[model samples]
Target: MSGIELKQLSEKVFYLPGTVNAAIVLNEEREAILLDTGSDKDHGRRLKKACDNLGVKPVVIVNTHSHADHYGGNDYLTRNFDLPVYAPPLEAGIIQNPVLEPIYLFSGAKPLPELMSKWLLAKPSRVDHILEPGALELFGVALEIIDSSGHAHRHYSVKIADVLVAADAVFGINILQKYPLPFGQDIGGQIASAERMADVGAQVILPGHGEASEDIAGLVKANIAVFEKAAKTIVGACTGVAATTVLKRSCEILGITIKDLPRYYLNHCTVMAYLSYLRESGHVELALQDNELRWSAAGN
Candidate 1:
């Protein structure tokens, strides 16, 4: 709480950041609608404490996406508040069985124990409501569920008044900031998602990983250029390139120097998944030529 800043966008919407951003919406009757819980088990406790400190009980929980950091506190919230949870309909299937997808082991700094990791996975659960883009009512405030799926393919950004919970669709490791995260399932879609949120024209853009920004539209525009260029580069160079070669080329193309993280971490491992997914999805093709593996994107 030392560096954390909790900003009230209005009586209905509050922006609180600690490790991640969470939103609190107040109903006319003073109940709360919570969005995107933090990254650990204690998040709900902290949330409840914050509520007690502020004097309101949260009665609803909305997960903008299914990532561990966003939904990790689901177990806690449901147990404590009997809140009805909601998610994008497309993702409810995965939510029903939230496995800590094998992909994260390669990206996270400290992986969960096998037993805990298995349990951390999403359980097949019921969503009280499934959302679609545009203005919708929740608690007392009017909310918007805008599709911003590039980060997770099923991610959504929650908007209340002038503030938008950009979710992972537009925040976290901005690859443009560094060696961009290998975590996305689709680079192209991720960039598109960023643009969609920006276009929503919010005054305060609350992202998933970093500080809130006012010029989110500009940020999205800039990163889209980066994404498009990277996609073109990957498509252009692929007959199949070595993993090291790809990483090196990626570093150069993204205008960032890449320091490799551990393979078990989700960051590095997701690179492998991205490539495999690209190949499997027919966005790219794979082959072994001259005893060196290479990749080629499908013709534009």
Candidate 2:
């Protein structure tokens, strides 16, 4: 919270920097619509303080996705204010049941304590609205919901006032450099979404974890490049190897070390996504080899 400040990006759009970026869009009535809260209650409290400092009332919260870092503060915000929480379909389910995140990551089994940390599990909050892709008007501000599902299932980006609140459709360059795989449920959809983002008629793009940029095309291109590189690496490693082996080999190639349970599961899920994308694209095929699931280049 030391260097965090509410910076205005447009006429009425402002953002607060934290472990994740949260945005505030002011409407005609001086009320604000929050675009994703920060990671937890403390972060929510800071956001509230920032809003109060700016003398705007946060009347609603539109969550871009169900990832803990994006919607973790929903409970806090709803508890203090009678706020309406909005989320996309599948993501709404997870946001209302925070445990589902770790459960899904653990393949529907009981997750270990290490995987149930606050970073992975947030307090569940009620979703008052289920958002759909298309035009939406909240608090007198018109917004177009662009389907950006890939990073998370049912993730949507909001375009208001020529600024796109691109939740996780595109990661910041620093984040992409750090985590080459960048946690996605559908690699193909993620790549397509990144391409779609390039065509978004927006002057500014605010990403979930990094600073907003006016160079939307540049960011989108970088994101696409990262996705392509990861897909190529995963496909190359899939030469008659077990899925786990492919993940391990990809990690080695990317210089990623699984230091913790969360990291391991995140990377594992991302690798599975890559496999799905490759299989769909007919570049790889799966087989049962001696009771172990194996993946190899197609037409083998």
Candidate 3:
């Protein structure tokens, strides 16, 4: 949390940049509404300090999703302040039972101890509110909750004061360059969400992992391009190939090396997302042969 500064985007909105970008929106009553907490307890403390320095109190925390990097500080924040935590539908369950993140990532099997790091699992915190996609008024601030699912199940973006807190609906351009195939559970939904972001009509777009930008159109296009390219690579690799084979070959095409369980599973899930997207779009189909399931281009 060293060297981090609270930057004010608007009179009502402030942000702290760290591993993840968290925003603070001041309501009419002078209380603060935290957009998302950062990656751990220390982040929560730092956020608290920032609020104190700004002369505001945080009365509520609205998590954009259940990913540990976005909500890991919830435990500390909730325990320290009398704040209500709000999370999206399916994500709320995972936030309150952090172990579920690793469990589901491991396909519902017991995850390896190494897979349960703080990056993937955070301490559990109670969810005081379950948010749905719609208009919400909290602490005198009006917010439009947009459905931005796919990066994570039931993920959401928040719109207020001309800034869109776009959770994981899209990644920063640098993050896209680093992980060519971004983690997504449903590629179709992810693409749709990116398109939705383009139509958000906000003056500024703040992604979960990147600096805020006013070029919402450019950002949306970049995000869609990444998804489209990954889909193409996966589809091209699917010439009667097993899912695992497609995953491996796609990683090779993207120059991504999976050296650890976390990286391996994340990329594996991403490839699965592409496969699902291809199948749903009628570009690919699945078949079983020799006791193994394989994917092939549709009508092949």
Candidate 4:
């Protein structure tokens, strides 16, 4: 397949691969269900074209999570087709009110200009359905919604036939290598989700941001390793260090550079996630002293 072209995943399922992979599932009537729209309207346009080229009419959209990139193309697709959108509960709130993304990222304050970019805030789109985990039937296709939260609150992955649209529960190996400290709101949950994928029993697994693979165990292990390594780095840095300093030191040790406000805030959020997870796991502790919140190794 060429750029943004469709690749077959199964008899009824196909995918358009780009920076973010969008899955296309077809019903007997040739109506399509889009698993995710890409980063913006252009991606939406391209996805629509790709489906058109396949001779399928997109009838529904399911956002695997609330992250902008996962649902950014929602507005364009919905506007053009008036399709019903489905997403998990908590994620649905953010997808409709995208400002919540930047708000929460800035610690519930008004976000700065840089934080308000499309990378963090996509245009608002309507969600017609709130998907719950377990068996679901969409346009005659049977699917199982698996709970894959942690990367984003209440995130989900879809399983159609023997193909599992794993979403971000487990990223592709290339993505894992590119981003040493993968983004997660709950490191422990992220690790658990990756582990869960090992037994999901899918013949083919499609990660939201990487190549699809048949090696479920290998993908699971690679993803879990990244989270565990990040946790270890954060715990090692937590020697009476403030959250910001911990993020800096951990990134430094990981050979990552926070080049801009967006990346800084993103890495900062992930670092805080690791700290929260480590503290709960009893590897680290949080304290308030001199009007500053700091962290250190447990029992320090």
Best by lDDT: 4
- Write candidate 4's Cα lDDT for 1-300 as tens digits: 332478888988898888899899999998999999988999999889988787889999999999999899999999989999999998999999999999999999999999999999999999999999999999988989999889987889999978999988889999999999988998888888888877878899999988999998888988988888888888899999799999989999998987898888999999988888898899999889999999999998
> Per-residue lDDT of 32-73 in model 1, one digit per residue for the tens?
888877765677677776766567788888888776667767
Q: Best to worst by TM-score, what's the order?
A: 4, 2, 3, 1
**For candidate 2, what is the lDDT?**
0.90
Cα deviation of 51, candidate 4, in Å: 0.9
lDDT of 2 at 180: 84
Q: In candidate 4, which residue ranges exceed 4 Å CA deviation?
A: 1-4
Backbone atom clashes (below 3 Å) for every candidate: 21, 0, 0, 0
Query: Please, what is the whole-model Cα lDDT of each candidate in the order they appear?
Result: 0.66, 0.90, 0.89, 0.91
Q: Can you give the lDDT of residue 128 in candidate 4?
A: 92
Per-model TM against the reference: 0.77, 0.97, 0.96, 0.98
Shift of residue 203 alpha carbon in model 4, Å: 1.0
The residue-by-residue lDDT of candidate 2 on 119-235, one tens digit each, is: 999999999999999999998999899999999978999999698889899998888888888999998889899889879799999888777889999999999999998998998
lDDT (10s digit) by residue, model 3, range 184-247: 9988889999999989788988888877888889988999998899998998899998999999
Model 2 clash count equals 0
TM-score of 2: 0.97
| Cα displacement (Å) at residue 22, model 3 | 1.0
